[model samples]
Target: MLSFPSRKHSSLRVALTALTTLAVAGGAAAIPTTSTATPNAAPKSWDETAYRGQVEVVRTPEGPADTEYLTGRVFVDQDRDSASDRRERGLDGVVVSNGRDVVTTDRHGRYRLPAYDNMTVFITQPAGYQVPVDESNVAQFHYNHLPEGSPELRYGGIAPTGPLPDAVNFPLVRSQLTRAQEQHCVIAGDLQTYDRTEVEYARQGAINDLAGRRDYQGCGTLFIGDVVGDDLSLYPDVKDLTSLTNGPARFLPGNHDLDFDSATAEHAFDTFRAQMAPAYYSYDVGDVHIVALNTVRYPCTPDVDNADGRRPECDDPENSPRYNGRLDENQLAWLEQDLAAVDDDKLVVVAGHIPLLTFADEGSAIHQVDQVREVYELLEGREAVSVAGHTHSIENMRTGDLVQGWQDLFGVEGLPFPHITAGAISGDWYSGELTENGYPVAVGRDGGRPGLLTLDIRGDSFRERYTVTGESDRVQTQLGINSPTYRDWYAERQAWNDNPEGAAPELGDPHVVIREDLAGQTWLTTNFWMGSTGSTVEVEIDGRRAGEATRTQEMRGEDQLIGPEWSDPHAVAQQLVHGGSVADRTMHLWRFELPADLGTGRHRAEVTATDAHGREYTDVLHFRVVDQP
Candidate 1:
């Protein structure tokens, strides 16, 4: 039997010990040293211990006589071994797939699917049970069968599998953790590590935080694309990072993860399928159903009139090939079939690499999915939410939220369900200055911090929250003052950037505002990372109640609001001085106009931001009303 250590006291010793000391000193009843909670406990944390095993591939004296079809069994492995024993019982009615066709196990947990070349056979993990994981904590449920390996490429693709086996058996163990109604699903985006240094940076930042937490184990962590930055060789090191996590790690294919050297789109993600996971798949946990999709169409041809403009680069595929955000016909057909098999009562979570629609690149057709309307029609009248990661920005777009580009290009007037663009793990390509924690302070293009999104699911509903890397949940919003003086300084800085000058002039003080500047127009801006249509922001100046702030980019069929007036000053100050993507536009920035007739003195502004779920986060900003610069 394989034994794994518990993570209960691994990272929370200091904090837990402090709480224990307080209880003992107060003379109250002592807290239990170990967990003694029941299976029905309201709040249950994962213990970080799981049965480490692999799939059992049974072989006979000779291979199976039948070569037309592949067969597999889903059984309960009571002995903790990968092989199935006589006493081990087969689990019936479990879902299995051969990339396109979905099937269920028979009475004896045996399933037969059509066999084909380059087909990936996998099973959708049923609720209340968990498939065995490898040493790296990666869910080992799929079998990649490529009779003939990938074509000649720069990166070594999948090695050819000789022939069909007798029987491929899948082992699963009972887990009460997944059966629980409350679950935390981690949606991480764009861990696009280009080299070894960025991998280490990821280790210190999000990976370190995940190592300390034990909340997400049942639902596991899903890395939605961009696993590596166009370098397929780093897949092993990336898997090593997942080994430190407390849950089963899964991945999706992104543009950067493509085999660019491949001659066709059929083999573009062959290496990814061998190392990570299938191009697209679906699974169930609790009352939620997650569908992972491969939305990147590589080496796209100009024959398809999907994009708004022509891509001259894709004219000659033999020479140059470009990737566009569009799903192929087969995957789209499979998606409809996959959803038809799912129960209507379950919450459908559609996850992909590129977003179906995004506020970051709202005007660019290639950046957003081409057949978005078709996807929406398929999920009509069903409880669904879309989560993606490719824009490297955090966007929490609610239902009925509309953008002009969506209307112009896809004819989408309002969103049918919530669409969240979980910010990138490698924020701004790991640009900007390095922090003391050994990781770069890689603020995103939307002026949002690099973080992971957690969908706290309870029954058929869910609440979303974003946790900044290496920071507590309380750190939700960034506060800054946008004034006329700052706008002038912004223009001066931009012009100086175009032409080389002796020394760049800095905005004397962003927090200080003159009377004339206030007379023109001054507003206190709040960059709430997860704020959406239903969210509200209120400001109070020096204990005086100010009016509620207005969101700059109201997703009401309007064009994108750009320029310094709408920019996040707090993020711009850092990006302009150091180096990174500018935060000139976003969908989550709120502004409250300051009183133009204020006195010349230092003042305090307290901002309280409330999300759609009624969760509130408060932050304070201090600025001076100056007479002159």
Candidate 2:
């Protein structure tokens, strides 16, 4: 986990890793193999101070000059034995650039290159190397370019066009984690390091992000789950990774974290517990009660034949994979007790790996629990929000009780609770190629760029912002509604898009105008997933109030968790198989009639939505009404 001292060191490691694997041939690119030390060089005393300086890496076409690359300077630990030393030389061949593009150092250990603003330029950890660190045991490396500066790029981030400078340098100094620093929390999901290489990959990916900068030192990072793949041995590596973070780090359990050797529910997460602490617990942070839950139950299906089926002890466990995803009765009971203790006015944020509901394939199954609504019902009227990760996608669905889209099956309509899918820290399982920054450019399922989620919790009201990878600013809201036309298009597209090995067309622009044919029996529908079951949707026409709406879910059975529990097969298949309406009412589909006797002028239709807690959200739609001849 704690691989190197600074971001430069880690990037150098990734660079070494990548270079080592590269097919170094005549035609293939020759990565600069520079070394910080010479054959006759003396082993200088190690510097003890953290390195603090500016650094920037830019992308450019192959230069006309033989030495088109630039040479930049970065300090090693400055205070050697607590005193400033002039003997240290710049680290050689430190890979630096935004993750996509890269550049190496000159003989003197200096690096220079074209400029790219608002980019995160970091060092690619050279293989078999280290960097400077502060007294608090946190690494001090990596540099950021807010080209337009910080606290102001609230609009779209750095401009792509350049008025760039020639150089950016980083300074080094020893420092300690301070209590007075503002608390910045890093929320990471599923490191899931499978092997040593993956462990290093994980280290290189996040360590660079953690190296420099001042934010996230107080609250530290809270990894939601799946710290390693099925192998639990990577926990120590995860610990090492967190040690590099500027603040305290915590974790929750994911499905893969379960003890494969365990025979019963009680001993299910023993391995995970041994490595990352308790499976289910809670802590207080800045007026927020963060509860980490272990939703994966050992034997997915409880067998009456097994001894102590109700409360099976781990010591004499029963081996079964029946419980791929779920919160056992005991944990549910614990949650009820834990939540009951919190003050109604205080904010309670429930964090877990498997979401209560999600847009992924196993959404209803491994995604959420059958009793999810029951849990939300308990939190009703309280300041609360649910956050989970397993889906590896960024989804922010407002909660309400009007079932139309995905919520039709459960018969639970309206806002039940606001549930957020915290997209993975290893976005798309870290599947992309290395960026010059030495990290992967992993994207989300919803096409939302990935990085992390930041919740600015101030008292009862909390604002969530999704910080996309590579982009400094966050996308606050994902607009677009579910109407009959878009629904039909989605249906046609989904049914024929199953070619696994074939090239596919784009899912189309995520941002689009959802066309709706309001004439005839057509209606404008909104499916607030399960969390919106108890919420309300208010429709207003031309400044006049229209009506209030409710959400509905299709319930299958008392034991069912995901998918269409009580779903009518027709409605459930409609998203993939379109036709006439199904027998059961689908809450994800909302219908609104166009007023009669209207002319061909543009009119505004405002839809105001209120969640279970009475929080109001307003969305205005522009449509035209034409007269029939």
Best by lDDT: 1
Judged by whole-model lDDT over C-alpha atoms, candidate 1 comes out at: 0.83
Highest TM-score model number: 1
Residue-level lDDT of model 1, residues 78-151, one tens digit each, is 88798887788888767777786666776677887777887888888888988888888888888878877888
- For model 2 the local lDDT of residue 609 reads 53
lDDT of each: 0.83, 0.48
Candidate 1 regions with alpha-carbon error over 4 angstroms: 1-48, 304-313
Error of 1 at 194 (Å): 0.9
Evaluate model 1: give its TM-score. 0.91
TM-score on alpha carbons, each prediction: 0.91, 0.48
Question: What is candidate 2's CA lDDT for residue 65?
Answer: 37
